[model samples]
Target: MKMAGKMDEEIDLGLAEELGVEYEPYKMSDDEVIEALRQINKEVPWEIPVSKELLPYLRPTILCEAHHPEIREEALRIVEGAETSIDAAMMIFYYMISRIKYAMEPPKTSPDALRTRKGNCFTKAGLQIALLRSVGIPGRYSFDKTLLKVIKIVVPREIFEKMPGKFTIHQSADAYHIERRKWIQCDTTFDEGLMPFPYNWNGKTDLLLLCPWWRLGHVGKSPYFPVNELLGRFKQRGFTKDFCAREIDPFTEHLRTLSIQELCKHYKRTLGRRDADSFAHILYFHFVGHFRDVHYNPLFRYDTNLEDLSDLQESGLRIFEPKYSVEKFEEWSVSGIPFEVE
Candidate 1:
């Protein structure tokens, strides 16, 4: 089976090279190579089949947008600046968390939603990979499933016994591993001083239920997934869905109508106390908080140990510093916003 897998990979690479797909030929292990190929294959449009000559360029375009001169230059700068493992890790984290802003309202693409900073986990991961690649580093995005169980509130034991079903939510975190290097887990959308260590988990990990949003449906169920389909459905009904979708213009207008405090209040009411707390932790740690039903899981939880940066550094892991100086961002303070819904 291993030999066959190797043969299959060689065939794919040969085909990709023949098609002129611009890709980095990294000397990775077979497993790493296969995984990278899988990611590339999954992301590119296979329907509009390209000539073997075109495959090389296809990857560079899809992966790095190398054609964009400015992006290319910035990516190179990031790569050039990394002098150590800590520097590299911090550079990637700071760039994604501080530079890429989380949209007040969802936008279609990371590049398009240019706030002071903006991106989802995917976009942030892409940005980090692009920067890493530009500097001659090999990195790939990875994900894993984690088990989470909801905590019981101050209810009588008898009352709790009457509740139906197990409480749990599956959440995803994106990470990139360098060849012979450590893997860094990043929640770009999370804020500083708000998360725990080993940023990504591989097995049955326990998480804290900080926000109701974390308890929502699975990943693709969020507005970020099938955004257009959901928005179209909303539009057909005169744009009346209570939950926000990716209608940038309308979403921006909606944001404008609510103060930061009002927005927090609305979120609290929608998510409830425990869930809201978890959401706040996400905001404080990852910086990429967004509203999604999947994030609203009753079982959403986080490890308090992961919340400390000092602990992470002591464990020989590097944490990224915030991109923006705290003073600069504090001007738009949403700190006073209550964690629970009104």
Candidate 2:
């Protein structure tokens, strides 16, 4: 007899064959996918009712908690109040990106996500979908591979020799199908400023590396090893808890051996070291580049004609224009996610 709960193992193979890939792509026909997911849910070993397992992975923690009714209400209110197409689109996008914190951290527990105001891209996308759907707007989530290209004027040839590939970041964009217009792409995570395009770097090429940013639960098994494992590796690298919080390390081996004692020592030492600030600045810059590589590189090209808020205003929709600057635009920190004009 086939072992109980073995259907999941077989489902993977079946899905792979259907998609013609090595792994399931998370794109499934609506009904078929739902039924297959139900079967997979039944196979889970957790004591929590399998029905609860169907909840979206990135849903807001406040929604899950008993006391935080305001979050859901506020989200619904914003959606209900949207008057024009632009307002609805902007409000949804703004709410999605602002609620989630940007971090390199792995998936969070439901409680943790509820307590903290930040999360990785996956969580942000999921929450956006849920909030949109809750308000009766038709929203679906999907992932695509994005190529990030960075152009530097005078980098050493040695750097190119060391690494060369299109850096790929997995991003999630949502679409709303209005009666007149077919589906249009609305990016929720980063500011939708002028969508960056591949042509922006024309004639100047320095380096390209494609790192995979797998959308959570969409791609095959995650490459994200646990934090504890990373802590252990940090110790091996001569970095101790005194250097940083064990929980903050993203590399698996370092997280594994991280200890509170080491952290205390590192914290104390970091207090007086003037270099600490500089070190942090350098680290932030490096991580920012990595984040850009994974999140912003493969940019969506928007209509250049729709460049200014005046266009929307001329179209008779209320538009909120925040102060704009070149630095902010370059960093993709344009306006907060767009929402319906209030």
Which tens-of-lDDT digit does each residue in 187-212 have in candidate 1?
Answer: 44432222211122211122222344
* Model 2 lDDT-worst window of ten: 199-208
Off by over 4 Å in 2: 1-71, 84-86, 109-115, 147-169, 179-181, 191-342
**Local distance difference test, per candidate?**
0.34, 0.32
Per-residue CA lDDT of model 2 for 1-342, tens digit only, reads 111112111223332233221221132233543453344333322121113322222122221221124434544465555544334544656544444544333333223443555444444444554444333333443444443221111112233234344432343435343323333444444222211211121111211111223112232212121223323333333333322224232332232243322322332243322322332233233323433443222222332332343543454322233222222222221122222321
Q: Candidate 1: where is the Cα deviation over 4 Å? A: 1-69, 78-81, 102-121, 143-180, 189-246, 252-260, 282-342
User: Against the true structure, whose lDDT is highest?
Assistant: 1
Each model's number of backbone clashes? 68, 43
